[model samples]
Target: MTLILALDFGGTKLAAAVTQLGSREWLRYERRLSPIDGNATTDLAIMRSLIYSLLQDATPDAIGVSFGGPVDFTTGTVRLSHHVPGWENLPLKDLLEKEFAISAIVDNDANVAALGEHRFGAGEGYDSLFYITISTGVGGGWIINGQPWRGNAGMAGEIGHIVVNPAGPVCLCGKQGCVERLASGPYMAQDAKEYLFKPANQLQGQQLRSLVNDNLDLITGQIISQAATQGDELAIKILQSGAWALGVGIGNVANLINPQRFILGGSVTKAGEIWWNTVQKTARETALPEIDFEIVSAALGDDAPLWGAVALAESALISK
Candidate 1:
């Protein structure tokens, strides 16, 4: 039996799994939340623990890793992580290969997730699709012509940085109104916190305030969604705005690539019907009438990256 090891270095979590080659189910799996103040070293330690616990007495033929950052696919070097520090210019692939004494492949999480969806999840039967994750940060991946499309320098699917509202608040990337700035879960939470902190808006977010017991710092995208579901105007507005920004980005991407489907995943995608409706409505309005496409939820949910990692491992084995 050929064993395949897969790892996902997510912004907020770490997951590792071992499965038999060609199997759809994992033989062993483990996951843990990343420390709130964790950096690359801490994250790596946690992943190493999970990997050992999963592997036990067995050795895998190959390993695959999904990193939540920009990566040079050819070299498997991580450029940087927007949400985590100490990950800049890391030679992750080499480290993994050296540590395990086996072949290892690594890529950006978004790109790997796209391949995961294409091979085993939402985009399974589709020849072309775009997978977008709207969680801690917003990112996108492309499956073009039934294959992963990591454009020049492996930076092709950076839909999060696409300017949707150039006049909006500044993003960490020093850009105003980028899709991730407006649409990601953390940004949505930040916007809510900022809005409620204003004197004039104090009376506006009553429902939102109540959700967090009037503690503005406690506000999160999930809290905002809960508030929206309870009829909080401020929360609803923020959620809709994020949806709108993502929709605009999607529409533009559709115009440029015309993929058959768009698969949305991550925490923010669970903001309920209002968020989903706004995204659909805005995308339809933004796209030309001639463009036809469908937007759907990801089937693999948070496990997409892990599954994608398996695919990457399988590919590595095949190439060898």
Candidate 2:
């Protein structure tokens, strides 16, 4: 049985799996969380261990990798990681090929996940789709004509930086009211924390305060969702704004690309009925009547990117 090796270098975690060329399931799998202070070196070491544990004595026909940040797809070099340092201009593809003596393909997490969905998940029957992840940050990837469309410089599908509210809060990308600034988990928590600190907004998040036991800093996107379900006004409002931002971004994307579907994944997408309803309603209102599309949750969830790595490896084997 020919084997394919898949590796995922998520900013917060790493995973490696071995699978047969035509199989839908893994033959062996290993995963580990990245250390809080890890750099490129430590992350690589952890991934290597997982690979060894999963590989045993068998050799993979091809390898595919998914990284969490920007990458030079043509050369398989990682530009940098927003969450971890020491990844600047790392020639990941070359190193992997040298280590394993086989062909390897690497791409950013968003793009890989999009490919995974198109190949095996919600986007299977769709020729054109956009995949969005809304957890620690908001990002997107496009699959057009059953092919991953990584724009020139592989910087396409950056829906997170779409400025939905130009006068609103500043994003890490140094833009005001970028979708990520309002819709990401960390940003939502930060917004809640900052609001509760003020005297006037004190009564607003009473349930949120109770959920975090008065530790405003303890507020997270999940916590906000829980509080919203329990009827926390502050949580609802913050979540609504986030959902609105994402909705506006999606609306614009629908108009521009007119993709068949939008598949949303990641932790923040689980923010209960309030968030989903807001997104759906606002997107409907924002888009022009002439444009139509559907938005759905990703079927592969957190594993989409890893599965996409499998697809990438499969493609390499097929081409060879």
| Global lDDT scores for all candidate models | 0.94, 0.93
Model 2: CA > 4 A from native: none
lDDT of 1 at 241: 97
Model 2: per-residue lDDT, tens digit, 1-320? 89999999998989889988878888998889999999999999988988888888888999999999999999999999999999999999999999999999999999999999999999998999999999999999999998999999999999999999989998999999999999999999999899899998767788999998998889999999999999998899999999999999999899888998999999998999999999988887888998889999999988999999999999898888
lDDT of 1: 0.94
Model 1 TM-score, all chains together: 0.98
Please identify model 1 stretches exceeding 4 Å from their true place.
none
Task: Provide the clashing-pair count of each candidate structure.
Answer: 0, 0
TM-score list, all predictions: 0.98, 0.99
Worst 10 residues of 1 by lDDT: 194-203
* Candidate 2, position 38, lDDT: 97
Candidate 2, which ten residues in sequence have the lowest lDDT sum? Answer: 198-207
C-alpha positional error of residue 118 in candidate 2 after TM-score superposition, expressed in Å: 0.6
| Per-residue C-alpha lDDT of model 1 across residues 218-274, encoded as one tens digit per residue | 998999999999999989999999999999999999899999999999999999999
Residue 299 of candidate 2: its Cα lDDT? 96
